[model samples]
Target: MSVDGDPVSETPTIKEGTWEAIALASAVMLIVWMFIAAGWIILAGEIELAQKRTAVAAAFVTAGAAVVTFCTVIWRGKINERQTNTARDQLRATEEANWAKLLQDGAALVFDSQTGKQSAGLASLEAVVQTQHRLFAKQAMNLIADYLEQVHPTDHRSPLAIAAIDALGSGHSLGFQAARSLKFEGPNKDNKRFAPRSIWVPILGVRLVRYYGGRMDTQYPHFNEACRHSTFEKVYFSKASIKDMSDFESCFFRNCKIEEIGYMIQENTFQSCDFSGAVNFGIESIDDMPDLRPRNNFYWSDRPPIGVTEIDWASRIISVPSQFSNVFAGERLMTKEGRDFIADEVLNLQRHSN
Candidate 1:
């Protein structure tokens, strides 16, 4: 009538009650039939036919009960499974909604007038990428890039632009069509655009370039890792610095002008790289040579700096530190043939330089 102190009114559905009643009636009838058969056997003195009939009836009753129990179990299992799937779907939807709201809030902060709020927005986007929310991060990156492209550059550092650059630098990969050209249009445009300054645009360890075609004019834009096979057609880099201090590094440059550049790294082969309009190279010594070390000592080591192996000829042209000299000497002297080979390559590069 009741279970666990709950009323029995809600316990049974129509189908469940029907099956329960059938089972109870069948059990009672089976007991009565057995007693009747026993009485008949005692009165009629061992009736074999009657015993066979009783056994057959008992088997049919047992089979019917088994079928009812099995159907009930299967129906309950299906109901439970449907409930579980519905719950999972609801949870997934809720999570997606939360992420969308977070992205909206971050975008609002980015466009805020306050510098602190803008920084917080950038930090939020960075957190998205760092946490492996690839879709959300990519969308945010595109929005930031577009905003940076539209805004005009100012004499003072623009916080929004800086934040955008920081976001782009933080990402491991980027995707967007490059701008056709970069120009400074306002008064003192030349000074603003081509000033002899050291601007920080650090993109240190990005390995993937989903899209890379742009007329970049930023000074001292650092690319310390591989950014090979991207085209820069008719780009201008007046007093710019490009450095790559790692192995198998390469990039592309086509019809680009350079007043003075510090290509102070090693083994960076520039494919189809042209420097027809380049100046300051005819001088005896170059100044403001770009250093290939990471900005902070947190990334520094005692290992010989980047261009050591590729620009081994620098030892002859400039003073070489004892540590680097020792390593180079040992490597060159590994065999008489190796020593001869290095000498020949160095001489070849020197001749070409002149």
Candidate 2:
């Protein structure tokens, strides 16, 4: 007997009891038919015996077919389930591989010091601006800048640096905006602070140093008024250029009591700042002076008689313990020499308004 809706097995396994019963039923049916025929030969009437034998044979075949069908259904269902599980496993594996590749690419972009790859990495990071993976973006930008600075000296001044500077200024998560100002100086020599030679982010260029009057020899509270408005103390440079010291104009001394001005040629600006406690500045120009006048209103100097005049011009001079002179030799708000320079500048500023 064959299973319904399934191909017949080539070497079908017959159950022992069922096979024996089938053989017995076949023999019984054959004997019944033969007996009926013999009776027919003898009496010519045996239709009931033949009908019963045929019905029993049909019932046995149907029972065998049902058993075969049930077994085939169970086997086919298991095979389909196994195939489904295999397909699901393959899909999961592919997803994992893709994710791993992406992470690898990200790390390479961050750590590798190649220009093209660095740019590509940054571009990729920009594409995912809304993503939570901001740490990677910041690290990549830092590394890219470092790499460019290492190779091309002018690259530090390139627009790429400006882009990064803008990004950092944006107060975004992908930019290094929150890190505190740190000055990593070289190893200490002669009681100076020791800092390993490494990357360091300064507080506010040189202006902060000026406002604080460098490192204090004595802990004096001689503050600068400029310190009061240093809202962007943590902001780097504030659009400062390599030519002009933007921080210089922005710096004011708060609660300051310094007596002398200090200057440092940092970046592009000459920082004219006051020093508190003991330190005072004297003009030590690289060029031999023709005439020297104090830019600030007051200066201190041991060499006196040339007290804080409206202006003083000398080949070389120091502002230390300088005498105070109330004798105004120039305009109330202008020095005798700076009048022309300031006049034209102030006029130009108000010219457009009127």
Give the number of the best model, judged by lDDT. Answer: 1
Q: RMSD in angstroms, all models?
A: 14.3, 21.9
TM-score of each: 0.42, 0.27
lDDT, residue 293, candidate 1: 17
* Local accuracy of candidate 1 as per-residue lDDT tens digits, 129-155: 544444666666654544444453321
| CA-lDDT, candidates in order | 0.42, 0.35
Superposed on all Cα atoms, model 1 deviates from the true structure by an RMSD in Å of 14.3
Evaluate residue 202 in candidate 2 and report its C-alpha lDDT on the 0 to 100 scale. 23
TM-score, candidate number 2: 0.27
Q: Which runs in model 1 stand beyond 4 Å of their true positions?
A: 1-68, 127-137, 147-226, 229-324, 328-354
